[model samples]
Target: MDDTLTSTLELAADWADRFAELTTDERRQLALWLEESPENAAAFARMRRLMSDTALIDAFDKGDAPVQPLAPLPELRAGSSRPARADRRKPMLGRRQAIAAGLAGALALPFAGYWLAGGQTAGSPPPLRFASRVGERRRFTLPDGSGLLLDAASRVAVDFSEGRRHVLLEQGAARFDVRHDPARPFKVRTPHAGMVALGTSFSVDHLAEASELRVFSGRVRLDVADQETRVVPADRWALVHGATVSTGSFDPTTHPDWQSDWLDADAMPLGFAVQRLARYSAAPVRIADPKLASLTFSGRFRLDNPRQSLELIGALFGLRLEKRKDALYLA
Candidate 1:
């Protein structure tokens, strides 16, 4: 480094202390000088670097000598030339004025800027979370190949590590099309139950008062509590609540009609088909009475035209329809 550059570094070692001793006018004059030349900015950056480097050395020094405070000093541009004597001779500012000026320059502007930006207060927005709303369904693929289907009004969070994938279903329902990976098991958590899988397709539902799980393929081990460890086989279903687990053979057709968008109720009750059919229609569709709700019929009905399907359902049940405010109320 040039001799003037080396001298500037030496002065910078006590720059803050020297700055404290200068008069207000001298500090103002130095500010003006810095503003006058691009060289002044470069010199300021170098001086700051020099101060940081010196601080590290000072920290390692043997004596607990109070660090001789750094003082403000004249600027030096990088050159074969030395600093002009006139710049060096400019008088220094005193402690109180220097503190005030430093506070205004270093503290107030940042404080004002943050306040104006509306972020100067105590908190940041709560961390981002994920959820699905009522009557809505959603799908998400994890960083792993495993897929998750969220049922109506559900919330779940995903956390994965090198050894396993875990999901916490805070509420509602979902289905999992778990990818095959023996080293890592896919696990789901609910208030009522826990599901651990070894590569499977399954659905889990948690309503306000009930929870159920259905396995379409492969196997899943459900642990309800210490007294129960139910291993659900392929094509099976289970209803769980508190410490109880009730397992049974899966009805594969239970979800196919809704998934396929074709209402095929084979000898299913007339009121039952009507209730199922109501989901796809915009209009309010219901059986006229509880007695009518149980009447049975079976056939494939087009999901597209709920009116025609309802008419079919009504004729089969010996009921008639009345339209009120865009809804078909059965009688």
Candidate 2:
């Protein structure tokens, strides 16, 4: 019931939101947090459990929180491999008890997804994980007939159950061509503030703490954490750089396709273009400083040769692009 524990719980909740789409640097940071103290690890574990326990929802729906022993989760509506299980059965801190432990404010935070979970709270489908090689791009067809185009070095997980279709872009970028299903909203999740598509065609690119979203076919309802959700008109793009939000319009029909060698960007960040070029490299490509992103690139460039493309980008910004130990760096 101390203030420290409560704050840690809140922090853990935010961390939980990003767990599905952590970048390499984020994973390292999480490891460091877990290593800070046993309490930190325990708090994170409880939040993770809270995310999957539908019994907690049942308790919340009723007038009281769960006070009983850990109960089994209902079978995933259908197409799930097996029933869900809960392991923390004992005298436990239910939501009410958690509130008593000074967690009321944390629960009230602007984490709508934490509460709704895209209608998959009752059951979780067996995850189907997919990843592309550093220089390879791949396409997939979901059970729901939607199409997923993963960019080079990207990874994502798909879950298709009776009521919902969820895609977790763990790292890298992907284009989603979703089939319209009102009953089952097609959503893409990331730890960042935005992402989650519905009946539309769009692409999401993630690097470090920023995310970029480009909509091609349908309008997208954009969510900026702790802010109101805004409607992004079709043929527009949105950017979340730290606390700043930038958006602009583009010719959706002329949007750059990674499949093609050249990408025509109109005032896109230098980091984003480099990230795409790095994907085609034989080794890892990284940016030395986030400040370098301040310089923007606004033209077409050949992507087939990553080395040459990287040099061109570096030269334009007056920064050096170098290779160190088989990894490429642009500063």
Candidate 3:
């Protein structure tokens, strides 16, 4: 019943808000704090469990129960800066006793959100695992009889269940050829948008943490949380970020080309293309002049021979290509 226990719980809640935003230094400090006392770590773990349990409750109440490839509790919800309501005048219960009391309601496990030490608590949602890297294209048949093509440096996770087909694109771009399932719709989650498909083929590109969804065929209802929903017609695209959604017509053919094994680009920045092409080479590639990074290029090159391509590109641009320690240098 000491006041110290109460302060520890309050501090744990404060740290939950920061887990996502903390800089490396702050995170290091947190590590030190946790290491300083076993009690501190225990309290933090309890707070995290509570946060997650609350999220599950919220998700269920809202009827958004996550399906397929169940995710660990999502990273703490955004804008959850509100403090836990507590009676300021109430006496602090013993740490062990308080946690014990919260444990008795087994049916409320999802709602209680408390767990013993060493159990899972909400953490960074694992970045969607991908089978491809930057500038590389990959194709895989999904479990739901659909097709998936992952673009360069893209990451995504798929979950096919009895009720829904959910895909989370952690980063970069991907094209989905979703099979028709009127009873169970296909959904794709990006940081900035949620796209629901009504039996269709579409591609979604998430750039710089922004979202752009393009439907090649069929229809997609794009929702930007709490914002107006938008219907993206076939062959058109919707660009969404934060709470804004802008619709425009774009050729799906022009999106990132994963069909090409080599580098396939259309008006990609010269510097970025160089960076990507560098991956195929034995040595690292460097641009000697900062100004060279500003140049843009559009073309497809076989990545198998990065050195040869570098030489060709260098000749075209009147630049020099230097190879050193597994890198190409554009001087």
Against the unseen true structure, what C-alpha lDDT does each candidate score? 0.57, 0.67, 0.61
Please name the candidate that would achieve the greatest TM-score relative to the true structure: 2
By TM-score, is 1 or 3 better?
3
Error of 2 at 261 (Å): 3.0
Q: Find the candidate with the highest lDDT and give its number.
A: 2
Better of 2 and 3 by lDDT: 2
For candidate 1, the lDDT comes to 0.57
The predictions' CA RMSDs to the true structure, in order, are: 21.4, 15.7, 17.1
List, residue by residue over 1-331, the lDDT tens digit for candidate 1. Answer: 3444333334323343345476776556556555655544444433332222222333335333223322344444434133343345435554432332232233222333232122232432121124554444567655466777765446676665447678777666678899888888888877777899867888776643346677888888887756567788778777774566666673676544434456666655565565555545666676556676656787788655677888877777667777877667667
What is candidate 3's lDDT per residue for 56-108, written digit by digit as tens? 44444464543221111122222332223444423544322233233322213
Q: Write the per-residue lDDT of candidate 2 for residues 169-285, one digit (tens) a residue.
A: 888888888888888877777777556565689888776677878888787777788777887766888888777778988776655556566666677678778777877888878
Lowest-sum lDDT 10-residue window in model 3: 67-76
lDDT value for model 2: 0.67
